[model samples]
Target: MALRTVLSDPMLRMLALAVLLAVIIPVGSQTRPAADLLVSAGVFVLFLLNGMRIARSEIRLGLRNWRFLLPLLLWVFGAMALAGMALSSLGQGLIPPLIAVGFLYLGSLPSTVQSATSYSALAGGNLGLSVISAALVNIAGIFVTVPVFFLLGGTGSEAQIGWESAERILLILLLPFVIGQIVQGWTRDFIARHGRHIIWIDRLVIALAVYVAFSGAVEQGIWQRVDASAWTWLGGMVAVFLLFGHLGSWVVAGALRLPRPDRISFLFAGTQKSTAVGVPLAAILFPPEIAGFLVVPLMLYHLTQLVVAAPVAGALRRAG
Candidate 1:
């Protein structure tokens, strides 16, 4: 699963390189605070840019299209999250507790924008809705994922969202986003001028966060804990998740009597998990070592989605 994500996307390849760098030069405890500060700044900028670029009309479009959007909401956060919880419950003795918690984390995340959008386009899906769905969920995940994670018994006492964490989220994530929206009208040309380059900002932050998170895990002996059997278990469990994600989304959308393009949007939006949202947020929410353990399932699910999405999109195209 790890190798697959690394192989599938250039951005993910950079992320893989980040993991390698973490392994080689793990951030010591002394340096972690500085690293955390940098990551927080990057996340603030990333979401700020997101707010600037995403037009308000698009958000309203997603909201008014409730017939298609509501089921998508249910399948993504509701069904997928439940699946992760059930699996997490089942894997108690079968896997490490953190990795089991990782399932719920992975399930709780929003869809990746690039993959879901690209695959939706390839499959002759509704491009506008796909784009909007991806963006909305990515934005919404910041607000939704952690609460849902804790509600589902993601961890014990150490895992609750302390007031400190909530305040940080509001300050870093929410505040910047609101500020960006406020200034977007004035900064339209500035954003348009460098919009393409802004994605690098997002990628760099995710990479840095991934590096720091894994550095903590390396410090905690991640490699030693994840032995041969654990790898095997991880592979099988992730496959089960992949199947459930793609197949279940499709089946549920069809059962909802969605037309093909809308159904395709549902499939793509429901199936993919965003490292963009997941890693940076995890860095903020969990301690570095715990964040590292939690992202393992996410890393695998992320790249594997790239591997499977092309073929799935092609199949959908053919069926259409």
Candidate 2:
């Protein structure tokens, strides 16, 4: 049962895949270029699948819960960005500037859908609200992230902000998503029938993206520049940020007088960040040199959220 549970755990599987790829893939192999291209294609397909799977009715329902959704959005997009900037300024001496930018990038991202909804359902939360909230935030993030990126001083030729870059982003990310949504009705039944398998495909793409990102970083002497102490500091900072986010959500939920289940949905929705969106956006928006560093914080935050949310979800289930 333990072995089966381990095998079935998506978080564990993703972490294992990342570790394996990081260890096995050489720093500058001939396959690096191919892997990079594959990562881009995989990300496009991942988003396409997302567009197809998301229910429009759920998104509308989430939007209708403006009282809950508005505050959550403010915290995710505003407070987190402010916190990241402050941390970056304070930790400049301790960690690299690029890594700080990574934190800012992580902050600017939207909440995740799959795990947030799954955990909320497990915890007897308002699963429909969770679904709507996650989907709405991510969809809104498609437009909001670029402006937030510039606000955080992530601007330059290399940072790739401008009309051309915007067009490229639309073509690569948004266009396919729109196309998928348009065709979703035809695909919905098929998607429902093979939902579990499709999720694995998403995970596989994400793992491949991580592998490609880290491989590039390894070649650029990321390990040499970021020592053990720096990693420890980075890890500590991420833990604090996550804890504060979760706690803040709980406080806000209570202040809003949210029902227990809605509170659970709001807390999880506000606290979680989307790795699926973040990794791909980093690859598109940032230069290769900094992209790897940009995604490190995101990957760390993703893992930390999974670790923290699992037990919390279990506790919530028991309490309910």
Candidate 3:
């Protein structure tokens, strides 16, 4: 994973463009209902493809490697979950309350399957373990992140999750994924034949998620609320989260005495966060305005991981 490779990523660029559009031309309230419907449909398609692409066999095989997978899960959701709680608690009066919540959500997310696996491979990792571990973590995330979030003080007037939100999560995110898994045996060839199309469609939905989420922030005057000082504070906190993630993953993997290749897989698997899961889940869990605000740290951390992982991968490769 070269720095330029991450920098040249069109998806990252599209994310920026989505934010720009959100700032400049947010969806109006008159169109909110329609936009909401469209975004929901996109999310359904996004997860459906995710299920189709990731094979059930991989998960079953990876589950047998508890020695490796268990530690990765605990480090990602447990240690990092506590880290986010501390950071969010410490953020009181220093940043906007909701911006701090971003830290909690960011910390609890699953490692990104694509970038983490790619970086692991670049660093001479166990690519098989990297792929399956990432997939398993993400699969766990759809169920884990929200409940952990709520239990960790994510519940209140601003961030409440009611029955309606739960139903939305099931219908929009879970049901489609189940359908994809059931039909994947039939659709495998079609998905493989149209891999390029699937990739673009995935990216478009993610971009639209960013657009829809950020538009609410724009409508709430995110720019006005997040000033120079707040931006500085936010930047500092994001850096802390990044440092904690990468360094913690490396140390924990070493302490576990994993072989070098397995250690490398754990390294990337523990550090990265998935906006694809985090954003849509946020939209369902919180109001669009609050979801937009909550995801700020997550979006920042997601890009930073791309930049940070390149060098880490290079270092690991050289070390290997």
Candidate 4:
């Protein structure tokens, strides 16, 4: 199969990711920092575009589902905390907690709209619930992330919660989302007529963001702190985390007597973390050096889950 064809396969996104990393490995070391920052800044627009496409009503509806959500949130965070403890016992020390905390926040993060809806539809989840869940998570991100960060020791124990980054998220990500909602309502016919063209633009923006962020991370020599053994450990950790996330979600869904469809939604949506969201958030959360380390486990997890979950999701779809 051709390279693009292979990449389009969810199972192969990991291979594509490997290629992305390989390209970044050598050149990332030599790139200028300013260029990287500019690119990173530019990537935020994709978040905006995604936000634009989200319906405000979805967010409003999310409040009603807090009953279903609160328990799931607790389960994910609690499990991650336990996993962090396990990692620490295994000589990973503080790294595991850091990774676990990062992941717990990652778990708490807003769900992806398209993916959640698609998976929910395939797996027999409440379509409205999926939409509302995604919106709620994102809206909560604006209000809850900073406090959660402090609670989880992400921003340090004494770190004062501020509105600076949250404001940026609102401006950079939320503004375009609101505009998109307007566009959808006001010029629904026009957008429908040009929807295909707009989608391509959206994709282009996302690709540009990925390239720029990777390049910036490279230019910053972020990989210098990681060695071959660390890579090996990370690879193993990602695999385990992927396994744990999916299986744990499945078990929990079953234990709760959730229907098959809701189980599927819970299994995939709850377990899947978005690098698209995580990377930029990490940069905003930490200094370059700290962000680099903080993000590595998440980046690894993001890639692994995509690669593994794509096939799993597809299989679930086919079976259904």
Q: What is the TM-score of each candidate against the true structure?
A: 0.96, 0.91, 0.97, 0.72
TM-score of 2: 0.91
Q: What are the root-mean-square deviations of the candidates from the true structure over C-alphas?
A: 2.1, 2.6, 1.2, 4.9
Residues 1-320, candidate 3: write the lDDT tens digits. Answer: 45687679888888999999998899889998888888888889999998898888998999999999999989998899889888888887888888887788788888888898999999999999999999999988888887877788877437787788889888988898899889999999999999988889888888887888899989998989888988888888988988998899999999999999999999999998887788877866666788888999988887888888888898889988
> 1-320 in candidate 2: lDDT tens per residue?
23444457685578567756675773366776677677778878988888899877777777888998998888888887777767666667787778877777788889988778988898889987888888988988888877887777766224447786687579778987898898998999999999989988888887777766776676777889899989999999899889888898889899999999999998898888988888777766654566777788888888778778878888888998
Alpha carbon deviation, residue 42, candidate 4 (Å): 3.7
Show model 1 residue runs off by greater than 4 Å: 1-8
Please tell me which predicted candidate would have the highest lDDT against the true structure: 3
Order the candidates by TM-score, highest first — what do you get? Answer: 3, 1, 2, 4
State which candidate, 2 or 3, has the greater lDDT.
3
Mark the regions of model 4 whose C-alpha exceeds 4 Å error after superposition.
1-6, 9-44, 60-62, 65-67, 73-108, 124-128, 156-167, 174-184, 187-191, 197-213, 219-224, 287-289, 314-320
Q: Write the per-residue lDDT of candidate 1 for residues 26-136, one digit (tens) a residue.
A: 999898999989989998888888788877878888888888877887788888999888877766677788888889888888888888998899999999989998888
lDDT of each: 0.85, 0.79, 0.87, 0.56
lDDT of model 4, residue 3: 35
Inter-residue clash pairs, candidate 2: none
